[model samples]
Target: GSFAVSSFVSTIGKSAFSLPFEDGSGAALAADAGSLAGYVYLNAGGTLVRQPGPVVGAELSWNGLRLTVTASLPAEAGISGYTGKPTCVSLSGPVAAGGSEYDVTSVMDGAFRSCKTLASASLPGVEEIGKESFYGCSKLVSVSIPDAKSVGVKAFARCSHLSELDMGGHLRTVSAYAFFGCSALASFDGGGSLKTVGSYAFSGCSSLRDVSLGPALATIGAKAFASCPIESVDLSPVLKTVKDQAFAGLEFRDSGGSVLAHTAAALRGHAFSGSGGVLVAEQ
Candidate 1:
């Protein structure tokens, strides 16, 4: 006779017993079970039950925050028969582990790099994104991180299919190569409090046409908007510096809708060296 098993149970009962191991290497009796220890036994209702085991790769903070250090799946939730890659991931709110609730705060560098199947991500509470966190995820299309303040270098570089990015109102910095080579990105609206755009941050985004620099923006780094097809830019008067080729190879129109004839004030170092026209400084 065969016994039916229920879903994963968080708490073990008094009658639970550890499942037998097949060898000294610590392999469990179940064929698909990983190296994590588990208990399998009959409950009061005569139904077999399994409990959730420990996760292998992650960092727990002293204050109840968790950070994903590696991209590997947990041992208890191993992908034994599923062959398709994960398409969507939601890492928002609190997660329960070891009888304690933890808020997932950040993703370590290169945590999800090259995950080609990842398409969308929602990180509402994450404050910082490490370098190369989602680099080379070709199928990625949308991302929503309303509370994120800083985006590290190469964090989302080479995400070819990424089109929508909601960086929220508190973002302050975009590091170099953050969204480089994302050919499908069409527009960017840097919400309030954005202060700096690092060199080459959005370089090589071929389809980028519209950009809204927030009021607090003060710097535009070298080649930051190079190779894009933008037609005009309404820069903030508080903007203090424009590095070399920052707006290279683009055309600009003035308030009257005519091509600008001369370079604008506060622009230096070939800021518009190769463009058809230069922007007019905001009065």
Candidate 2:
């Protein structure tokens, strides 16, 4: 049942009440009129709270989900949170606060940085991840961002336990140091849509061995895969350039274990520096 804003009694301090919306969504509103002078709505997926202020930002939460609003629009916002120490997070639709519904499309910079307790995250609708969003989250193991198109600089840097990443088919760019120092990461396949990998993107991932550079890959930045144990990678036919030391300390071999030949025109100075691998010109 819907309740008017005027129906709230001041005496109903620190109490909770349930209501049914016209859209058939069930919600519970909790408030502490004594001190917190604000409304917190508990929906199916999460909680949306309107903080007492000029309505600049809000705090969102649920059983295993917590988000802090960073940027607010009339009907949208970017979110990030680390205070609640949530172990698992799942985000799906718009969240309402201060009489407005916000569609969460991005995770703000340094959102969950250094949150050592976080284990996994599923953001099916998020389109972008800002710089250092999950940086230093040492316990994070898996992340699924099916709709994400771009990953910002050092987004997942130093997430030492991160092993699985589902970057979906729409991903195009992985910025510098995005996955740096993710030592547990095993393999990465840029599902036919990736175009650019920035400098040191996967550097220091000692466990990373298998990699599939998508068919659309165009550029590989300096030391992109340095210090990895990767044995081979089939460069895309349309690859335009490989910067200095892109594959340092790695060997390049074909399926038959023979040293694979690369196009000399595409490799910059010392592209294979510190590695036993060699590149030969096409006949």
Candidate 3:
């Protein structure tokens, strides 16, 4: 397939350089990138360490430069209400670390799953959005993740209300299911230092209208934009490859709900299966 978006449109998945690295498959990299066999400590010291929390996903904690990783949250951690699945209806706080002595990065795999009432979220200056970090945060209408370089699988899956995402121009990759099911995400401004966009990176994101691919982008993984209902998409000239099924299920209706011709042509095969809209390319 032609690498340029101007030449072709199709559907896809991605590589190891920056992997969501699920199932600890890339754990071997630890030996080469950094030591994983030792007890990482935190206290404003050496390189930061990310530990897996009781929640099954990774959590980030820092003491200036040093980071620590572990496998559980304290009994009083906000992720879990005192002793069980947080079932309270009250949303409180700038939920700080709570003076608790435990890894902060790891959250219960679904700590905030489908927390539709949440409207705003802020990542601690030191935090990185880990795998499935905010999956199903439907109520999160607006939020930010700065200093975020590497995001894991399903990091922002199903964040239906996210209208905008700012990559801060420093991000390196967009992993599988990174923004999958974020039906309300309209646009994302990536540093596009992004070398790779993985499988279903934006799968099921029906509301994304348009995005500017940065100059540094190189690869577009499978089904990266599957099932999105946008009217048009503008791609960067610097792109080198767009894998199979990378742009599936894409079509848009204007104020009057009419499908634009160019949008239909370019996304012919990539458009969603159930959608009757035709793919049309831009002039």
Total clashing residue pairs per candidate?
0, 1, 35
Residue 213 lDDT (model 2): 71
lDDT of 3 by residue, 89-137 (tens): 2222222332335433323334456665566654433234567656777
- What does candidate 1's lDDT look like per residue over 133-167, in tens digits? 88999999999988888888999999999999998
**lDDT values of the candidates?**
0.64, 0.69, 0.51
Residue runs of model 3 more than 4 Å from their true location after superposition? 1-111, 231-234, 249-283
Using lDDT as the yardstick, the better of models 1 and 3 is 1
Query: Which regions in candidate 1 have their CA more than 4 angstroms from the true location?
Result: 1-84, 253-283
lDDT of 3 at 118: 60
TM values, all candidates: 0.65, 0.68, 0.53
Model 2 lDDT-worst window of ten: 267-276
Model 3 scores a TM of: 0.53
Root mean square deviation (Cα) for candidate 2: 12.4
CA RMSD of each candidate after superposition? 12.9, 12.4, 14.6
- Minimum summed lDDT over a 10-residue window in model 3 is located at 1-10
